[model samples]
Target: MTTATTTAPPVLHLAGISHTYSGQRRRTTVLRDVEYTFERGTFYTILGPSGSGKTTLLSLASGLDTPTRGSIAFNGQDLSHLGLGRYRNKHAATIFQQYNLLTYMTALQNVTTAMEITGAKPATGSRKARALQLLGDIGLDKAMATRNVMQLSGGQQQRVAIARALACDVDILFADEPTGNLDEGTAQGIIDTFSDLAHQQDKCVVVVTHSQRLAAQSDRVLNLRKGKLTEQANTP
Candidate 1:
């Protein structure tokens, strides 16, 4: 006789999440009682039309902003109680379309700086070796890593950004329009990198994008409309 063990809870749980803006004339609601759970080892895509509050959801999820109602928890701990700063520093990392790399620093330095800010524990491994290894993992050669971010191609810069995020060694990765500015080939490469990170590295990957191609490649496609999330069936 054998007993079955229960799996751990989701990495991220959104409970009745809602947000709104109050103006002198009136109030506008952006999100309406949204519920979602994002688990590890999966890549999920959130798609929506313009002004549909996609960025707002990402902001709240990343702790860049708070919801007007409801709560979000990571690893069964409320984000509010865990503290947004600590959560951002120690629990998750985001990759943005703009790359957002420090213009003054080389690619390696950019990653090194991010790890330093997060104060990544030594338990995760050595900062220098880890940064170099991460950059290599994402297809950036040592020569590219040594160049200033401004000197690298868009695709190269994005890879450095991804490396920086991974250097944090967080369980969850959030991306916003990551391939928006890249060419078709470059975009596909970036998408592939994300997929590898989710499937092989076991990082919970969530991307907010308008690209249907991206959604198609994801393990799950979620449509966000007027503040609600609906799972989309795979098109035949």
Candidate 2:
């Protein structure tokens, strides 16, 4: 008897995707024919200048927005057919640069609420247990976790955002300038967490950052320039 082996499709794919912002008098195009394939168990960092549209690309890939032209797919299925809201809730999690936490909730509440909304359940414990653990892992202790997010500092709130995303237990993780508000040590720890998510957990981790130190640790380095996305050779 002979057995057949099947390979899984890429976690996320962008095919000739372009995006533009239309205004009252004129339209501005940010991306042009951007094609990329992101696979599981890999960490990717996108480098670009302030106006290079890295956020737009991340937004499209994370299902927060659709491209102006072309298409995006997850696991070989087009996002259009997959339903953007469903994709975002069930498959992808994003850590916005602004740390979009629920203002009325505590740090722990923020994480647990995300897990609840995403329908993520822990294998061995209650959702509260998992949320607390994830928050602690990101350096927020029980005291900080119990406090409202507004009471926390910017770096602390950023950690809460990261914990919320981690608790979602999604397939793809997207982060934008995640370390911008952190100190050096904390920033490095977050980078390590991202690396572990990709290599250890087999998740597709994509981060948009201007930090070369963070980019150097990623498995792949992508650069967005002049409305084009290109990969740079890995450097030591």
Candidate 3:
């Protein structure tokens, strides 16, 4: 007897997504008829020139904003039906270049704050402990996690943000210019963390980066031009 085979559904899928902004004088189209599928266990890099809508695509994919047309599906469910807030809370996380953490909160506090919104109650330990462990996983020890985010270096703060994103316990991570402020070595370290998150932890990581080093490390490279997406051969 032959056993039946099953394929896992994509963690995220975008079909014919387009977005346009309207002004009194003119209507501007940022994205047009873009189609893509993202699955777990892989990292994707989006490359595009400035004003090419790379950020716009990331925002839409992470449920920060909805598209003007078309659909985004999360875990096989239509995103529109999932509700944007629910989609972000349960299925996705975004890490911005600005490190949009609560400025006055400690690293740990920022992480736990995200948990509060997601309504997560860790089964193992207190929420704070879970936050510390997550920071530790990203190489931030207790002392670092307890420090105010303002005191941390660029790279350290980025890791703390990554920890916060992980604390959300979602399946997809969206990062925009994540390493823009770091030095070469620190930037590489950040990229390495993203790699491990996708390949080892089975998260679907989508990063918008201008760094070739970053693109080279990703499992797939997508080029955005005039609001369209085309796959590029992965560079060794």
Candidate 4:
């Protein structure tokens, strides 16, 4: 007698999804018939040129917006059925290229506020401690963490945004040009954190960037061009 085996569904799946933006006299289709599956414990990087709809793809997949055609599913349940807001609140976190930090709040406050809003609990210690540790891990010292974001440099604010997202404890982490504002060494550290989040913590990480160095570090590299996306060979 032989036992049967079962396979788990993808953490996120996009099936024949297409998105179009309407203008005054025309419509622009950014993605066409895009089908892909994102699994947990994997790091993915998306590379694309300007006007190629990389951000749009990220928005759709991250539940910021729905596709004009087709469906997106999280763990086999359609996003439309699951409710996009609910999905975002419970399962996904995004680090935007603009480093959308609360300018009036200190770095530590921004991270802790996000944790509170997301109801993310630390494995140990209080949320403030966890936020401070995450901030420090990304090169922000205690003094820097206590300073208002407006006083921090662009790169420092970027680190705070990353820390805020990381503290959320979401299943999938999405980033757009995550390291564009950082120095080489700091950027590399962020890349290492992304890898660790996927491999060690069993989370899915997706980043949209134009940097080949960042792309080279991911498990899968996908290129989006002319409204289409294709995966390159595995990075080994």
Q: Give lDDT tens digits, candidate 2, residues 89-172.
A: 999999999999999999999999999999999998999999999998889999999999999999999999999999999999
Better of 1 and 4 by TM-score: 4
Q: Report the C-alpha lDDT of model 3 over 1-236, residue by residue, as the tens digit.
A: 99999988899999999999999999999999999999899999999999999999999999999999999999889999999999999889999878888999999999999999987778899999999988887678999888999999888888888778878877999999988877777678778888988999899999999988899899999999999998896432
lDDT of each: 0.87, 0.96, 0.90, 0.96
lDDT of prediction 3 = 0.90
Cα-lDDT of candidate 1? 0.87
lDDT of 2 at 67: 98
Instruction: Please write out the lDDT profile of model 1 over residues 24-95, one tens digit for every residue.
Output: 999889899989999898999999998898888998998888999999999999999999999899888998
lDDT of 4 at 106: 99
Provide the lowest-lDDT 10-residue window in model 3: 227-236
Clashes of 2: 0
Candidate 1 Cα errors over 4 Å, as ranges = 1-7, 23-26, 121-126, 137-139
Worst 10 residues of 1 by lDDT: 120-129
What is the Cα-based TM-score of model 3? Answer: 0.90
Per-residue lDDT, model 4, residue 223, is 90
Whole-model lDDT, model 2 = 0.96
